[model samples]
Structure formats: C-alpha cells, structure tokens
Target: MKATIERATLLKSLGHVQSVVERRNTIPILSNVLIDASADGTIRLMATDLDLQIVENVQAQVEVAGATTVSAHTLFDIARKLPEGSQVRIEAADGKMLVQAGRARFNLQTLPRDDFPVIAEGPLPTSFELPATALVQIIDKTRFAISTEETRYYLNGIFLHVAEDPAPVLKAAATDGHRLARVTVARPDGAEGMPDIIIPRKCIAELRKLLDEVDGSVHIDLSPSKIRFDLGNAVLTSKLIDGTFPDYSRVIPTGNDKLLKIDPRSFEEGVDRVATIATEKTRAVKMAVEKDKITLSVTSPENGTAAEEVPGDYSSAPIEIGFNARYLLDILGQIEGDSVEVHLADAAAPTLIREGEKATALYVLMPMRV
Candidate 1:
C-alpha cells in the first residue's frame, strides 16, 4: 500500500514478521508479505506458511491507503541497507511498488493481496498473561531437550502443564530418550487454574525471537486446536500437535542419597577437555569421586585419554558415573552459580543436579550404562 514510514521503525517490525515466511513454499504468495495501510497513520503486515501465521502493526504515514503483497525478504534487505533515520516513501500503482529514501530508489514487483493467506481464527476461550522474562527463562532451560526425531510426533514439542506440587505451578518439559529437562514456574495472575498447553518446537522458537526486545508482559491465549502469543506490536499463531506428552514426573529420580558439591565452571571445563578424546558417537566422560575430590577422565584407544581433578566439599561415599558430555554442558550453560550440587543414588541410577542455592528451576539426567 502507499505509505511513508521511518526506516528504523519499519525495519524492526519487518525483521520480526518476515521470519515466519519461508523462502520456499508450495504456494507462491506464501513467500510474500501482505502490507495494508490505513488512513489513520498505521500499517498492518501479515505473513504465513499455511500452518503458521504472523500479524504485526507498525507506525507509518498513510498517503493513499491500500494493500499489496511483496517479497518480505527483498523489502527487508532494501530497508536495512538504506541510511538510518531516513524517511522512506512507498507508493503502489499498476502492480508495481516504488521505494525511495535519501539518495536510494527501488522498484519492486507486487503480488495480489487476495492470494496471501491469513491464519484461520479460533474461538480461544482460555486466556492468560505472564511476564515475558519468565517465559524466556522456561524456554531457555528446556528447549535443548526437545526431541528432533520426527518419527515420534508426540515428543516434538515442550509439554506445558499444571505441575502437581505443593504450590500450584506450570511446567515445560522436553526429552529425546537421551536426556530430559523440565522447568516449573509459579502460575501468575489471570493464569490461575489454566489448562495445560503443549506448544510445538517451531512455535516456541518463533515466540522466543519476539521476546528478546520486549520488556513488559506477554498475553497468552489458547484454543483447543491453536495457540496465540500477543507481544505488543507482533502476534504469533501456531497449530498445536494433537498428541500427548509423556509423563515427565515419573522419570525424575525420587531418592538420591549421595551428593557432590563442586564448582560448576571447574566441573564443566574438566568434562569438556576429557570428552575430546572420547568417541564422537558416545561423547561419554567418566566421573570418579573419592574422599573430597572429583576426578573426570575419558579413555579412547584411538586418541589416548584425558584426566583432571576438581575440588569439592563432599566427603560422602565415592561413586563413578558416565554421562554424555553434551548433556552435561547443556545443563551447565543454564546454571548461574559458582557451585552446583549433583545428587546420586548410585552410579547406575539417574543423576539430579541443582544450584547450591536451588534455582527456581531444576533438572535430572538419566545416566548412561558406561
């Protein structure tokens, strides 16, 4: 449509909404962005890939109000390369668009706006709001565990549900048969007694991208078949996976007696160096704890072996455990403390890890039979 918008403001919203449009699509218009300008100095942008859709509102100077569909990536590229704070002038006529700002000028071809798809509307009955920071934390902690195995469609998304704990809570969990990660946060106001929502992996990734610059809260609304995230200027909608997530509570170890408290960095670095010699298929690093020190080692006939020691404040019975080096590194990345406590019932059982001062979040790892 015909409108004038500030270069920086237009780029920000376009950057968020344009990501939803895939470069290649079965339908031609699906690769383009729908731009609608109103007489009230506001512009609406829409993009979709049939299943997922995004709608965003941006500020603009409306001249001749109308609508058009153009290449989202191409427009974004042109706007980004233009001078900062320059006023961009856009006009649509005769199936062509003329873009001008400062000394630069671009003429882009346009597609019919009617061909662009809008995500179907759902009568979402359950709605709630939560702090954007809290949602971001939950995603960061558990997204690493989401299964990429497409054959098992049920395990492809984060399981968001009401946790059965002393305090009412909501949790998100993911596992790929190798390692499991679950994060629980107290339910916020308006979110009281909300039904569980299992969001797909792509949806979580898209929603997380929008939250990076947001400071206020995000409004969450869900229908039985769809989920929508309202992040002020932008909105993300996705179809939910019609399958049940496996019960994660049962997998968490209930009784772990021996505890190993060691500096998180020291432990992480030791495991990282030793795992270099281990086989790529099984990057297993062995942990041997005795008296008051924890020794990490990996032996590979092809590349020799590596061994190192990390001091700990533990005098409990010694234990030896083998784990995937990558899994341990994932959990360590989420840890925010100098020391981390590892709980073990036995070398053959699952290992539980928590911050010395327990984080609002916790994780348990199923040990490998090394």
Candidate 2:
C-alpha cells in the first residue's frame, strides 16, 4: 500500500478508528488497523475488537492501490507527533511499512491483510435519521445512570425504544438500581416500529465522542442484534446487548403528592457541603423539607456532622428523605432549567425529579435509610 495524507487529517481519522483497538490482544491482527488505499484517491482505515468496529475514510494521494495492517496505536502516535502541515507518506512492501514525514521516519511491521477479520454486515430493516443535537441531549441526560455492574448485563447500557404517549416519541433510559434517568424527544421518521435495544456502555461512549464534531443528521440502521451509525466520513457498527431490560415504567412513581421547587445551584451546593462529613461508604445526605426551606444534613461516626438550609417552595407536609450525595448531584447537573421540581412520597419511597412539572426528562432516586 502506498499513499500520502496530511498529518492533521491522518491523525484525526486515526483518533476515530484506533480507539476500538484493545491495547492488549491475544490475537495479533486484532491489535492492528487495516489500511486500504484505493486508486480513487481515498484511504479507508478500519479497527475492531470483534464486538465493535469503526471505519473511517480520508482523502489521500494514492500511488499504489493495496492494503496492509499495522499497529493502530503506533501509527496514531507517529501521526500525532508529526509537525503541523507535514505530508505523511506510507508505503508497505516485504512485510514492512515505512512511515516518513519531515525529519522523522519509522519502519513498522505489517501483518497480512487477509488475517484481519471483517465483521459480517447483515440486512438491517429499520432505518432512521436523528438530528445530532437531539442525539447529544439524549445521551447526556441518561448515560450517567447506566450501570457498571457486570452481573446485571442488561442494565449496563442505555435502553433505547419508541414510546407512545398519545404521540410517538423516542426515549432513552438508564438505571443503576439506585437511580433512573429517562429522556424523550419526538420520534424521527421510520422509527415507529423500531425494536427496543440496549446499546452497550462502551458503544454509547465512543459514539458520543464521535458526535462532538458532527452536525446535521446522523443516519442509523438497527436490527435486533446489531446497530450501525453512518457518520459522514466514518461508520460505526456495534453489537447490541442480548439481555432484556427491566420494565422501567413501573419504577416511576405516579402518585407523589408533595411538590418542592428549589434552585438547583443552591440545592447542589448544600448537598455537597453537608455530604463532606458523610461516611465514605454511603456518602448519604438527609434532606428535611418543611414549608419554605429544605435542611440538608449529614452525620458520620468518624467525621462529625454538617447541616445547611436551602430555600424552596414547598407547602405540603414536612418530609425527611435520605439519598446518595453523588447521585443527587448527578441528577441536578442534568437539570437545564433554573428551578428543579422534586416530587416526594415518603422517606422510604422513591423520589422523582424534573426540570418542571411537564418536562420531557425525569429522574428517580431510591432513598437511603439514614
């Protein structure tokens, strides 16, 4: 393979594809990226770890049309350190790949292209396009709630499906047993009959990073077992989690009578200050809500006790609830509005939170015993 590409362009493309390559791999080919130079003036780079794959295309000057495999991280590092605007020349012959730019030159070992595995592309029946901004919002609001516990594999990803609340809407939800977050947006065209799927945690993270620089709409093709995202010059394909997600609707409380509206900034600050004295294991903060103020307090056997009062608009009966400080801060950070609405049932029941009474995004926290 022989091709010439700009240093910046090559580095950007490598950054997108090389992240999928595992640092330590039992299989030799899995650690390398397949670089295919075509006579049509473009080079395609592909890297995968069996479950997830990323393919990126960059414009380059192709001298000889061929394909070779080289260490993805090594090539990325070489391109990253190259001076700005330097032209990178890559040529592979005799099981060796020569990389040269400016005053730097490195000979990297090449593996046979035939050894690289290509994930099979099956027919994907459902197709839809979502605005980049909407996709970003969906991921940002719910991804933090995704469970890291490997035993409950189904909860290790965001649950994406279409919900019909009089009108069809696309919803993304994640839960880690202690907290649940749900966000919804208007469903895109051709998504009415889409099957519910759990997008794995790693795939969600990689896709989120790729979306940072993207604008316009992203094309998505989905099946029961696999999903493919078509970013303008890059394509990502990932396998969906096979397990079934729990029925999250049942967990959301619908009969909470008390309403408390408070400034998210003040509430967050109070929680942070009070939790400073909380036990390291629980990190729990107790909230005592009254007519017009909420008292946040924490007591630790080793560290003393702390308390603070935050103003609120609560007229219902007083209630005391205990919650994980980190989880409370996470949900508060997602609140886009100035005021956050807190719905309380009791100290033992789950509490609901939202930006407003009719907001599309909602959060539920299971209270802890103080």
Candidate 3:
C-alpha cells in the first residue's frame, strides 16, 4: 500500500490504534497493525490483541490501493518523532514497509495483511447513543473500585445496566470487597431493556482515552458476547467477560443511620495528615466521630501516633471505625462538591459516602479493624 498522510493526522490515529497491540505476542502478526489504503482517499488502520480491537480511518492521498501489516509501536514512534507539519509517505515493497518523512527514513518489516486476525462482526441487536462526557463521568467514578483479583474474575470490570427505581437511569458500579462505587445518570434514548454486561477493565481503560478527547456522542452496540463503541471515525470492539457480576445493590448500605457532613477537601486533608503514622503494610486510619467533630488518627507501634480533628456536622452517638487510608482517599477524590455526606451505622458496618445532596453517585467503604 502507498499513501501520503499529514504527520499530525497519522500520529494521532497511530496513537489510538497501537495501544491495542500487545508488547509481546505469541503470534507475530498480533503485534502488528493492518494498514489498508483505498482509492477513496482514506487509510484504515486496525490493531487487535484477540480480546480487544481498534479500527481508525485517516484521510490520506492514496497512490496505490493495497494492504500490509507492520509493527504498531515502531510505526507510532517513527510518526511521533518526525518533523512537525511534514508529510509522511508510506509504501510497501518486497515484504517491507518504508516510512519517509523529511530527512528521516525508516524501512520496517511487514507481515502479509491476510495473516492479521479481524474480529468477526455480527448483528448487534441492541444499539444506543450517549454523550461521551456522561460516559466518562460514570467510568471515572467507578473505575477505581474495580477489583484486581484474578481469582474473582467477575469483579474485575464495571457493571453497566439500566436502573428503574424512582426514575429510569443508567448505572455503572464496581467493587473490590473493600470498597464500592456506584454512579447513575439519565438513561439515553433506545437504552431501555438493554441486557446487563460486564465490560472488561482493559476495555474501560482504552475507551477512556477516546472519550477524553471527543465531545460528541458515542454510539454503543451490544450483543450477548461482544460490545462495540463507535466514536466518530474510530471504532472499538471488545469481548464481554463470560462471568456474571455479583449483585452490587446488595453491598450498598441502606440503613446507615449516623450522618456526618463535612467539607470534602478538609476531610481528605485530615485523613492524609493522620495517615502518615500508619504502617506501610496496613496503612490503616481510625475515625472517631462525636457531636460536631471528627478526629482522624493512626497509630503504629514502630512509627508512633498522629491525629487530626476536622469540624463537621455530626449529631450521632460517638463511633470509631478503622479504614484503609488509600481507599478513603480514593473515594474522597471522586467527590466533586465541597460538602461530603457520610452515613455510618457503627464501627463494623459499611459506611456510605455521597457528594453533596445528589444521589447520582455513592460510595460504600468497608471498615477495617484497627
């Protein structure tokens, strides 16, 4: 294939498609990206790692209509280092791909395009569109809580489903046994009766890259086995995890009676200060709440003790609870508003946290024994 593409355009598309290519591959072609040049003035780039596939189209001047595969990362690096505003000319000759830009030239080995695996596309029965910003919000709120444990593979992804309680809404939730994050937004059109699916962690991460740059709508198509996202000229398809996600609604605390309202920034700072004395292994911090004040303290036999009191609006009986400092900070970081509402039942019960008065997003953190 032969084509001339703008350096900036090629670099951006390469940056998106190359990430799906794994660094090491059992199959040589798996580490390469398929480049197809058509007479229609566009070049199609595709890369896959068996589970996830990304396809992007870039505007180019096609001199010859053909296809070939080349190392994804190497091509990306070459494009990135090329001179600004230079035109990149690529051509395949005698099983090698030549990349030329200004004074720099590179000859990369190529694999037959036929050897590259293409993910099969089937009829996607359910399709809907949602604003990219809203989707990013859901992912940012819940992604941190996804479990990294391989044994319980079901908890390794965020669960996406429709919620129909007080009103119809789309909800995303994730949990790692120690903590849980749940976020809801108004359901998009054509999302009703959509089947619940567990999107793999890697898919969520790669999709986030695209969502961060685009302000347009994202078209979502899902079936029983796979999910696809179309954002402008780029398309991403991923296999759905086979395991069923646990019912996350059961883990969210409902009867936590003690309520504590405090400034999110102040609480986060207090926890950070007291956590300095915590042991590196456990990193546990204890919270003592009484009246209108809450004290965050950590005690380590080897590091001594540290405590900080933060003023809050709390009227419940005195309660003490231990929690992982890292987990507390993660939940606190997600709070967007100044005021944070924390609901607690006792020292051992799970505590619920919310941002301001909005029920759109909530966090549940399990207590750690000090």
CA lDDT, every prediction?
Answer: 0.84, 0.94, 0.92
Candidate 1 error regions (>4 Å): 356-358
lDDT of 3 at 349: 91
Pairs of residues at least 3 apart in sequence or in different chains that clash in candidate 3 = none
What lDDT tens digits, residue by residue, belong to model 3 across residues 115-199? 9998886888889998998889999999999999999998999999898967999899999999999989998888889888999
Off by over 4 Å in 2: none
**Number of backbone-clashing residue pairs for each candidate, in the order shown:** 0, 0, 0
Model 2 lDDT tens row, 175-222: 999999999899999998999999999999899999998899999999
Task: Give the Cα error of residue 329 in candidate 1, in Å.
Answer: 0.3
lDDT of model 1, residue 56: 89
Worst 10 residues of 2 by lDDT: 351-360
lDDT per residue, candidate 1, 1-370, as tens digits? 6789999988988898788889877777887889999999889988887778889899888988999998999999998999998999999888899999988999989998877777786687778888999999999999998889999888888988775577877878888877788887887656666666678888888889989978988998887678888999888889888888887778788688788888888888888888888999888888888878988888877888899988887878888889999999998888888878888888778788888534776778877766
Against the hidden true structure, what lDDT does model 1 obtain? 0.84
* Candidates by lDDT, descending order: 2, 3, 1
Residue 305 error, candidate 2, Å: 1.3
What is candidate 1's CA lDDT for residue 316?
80
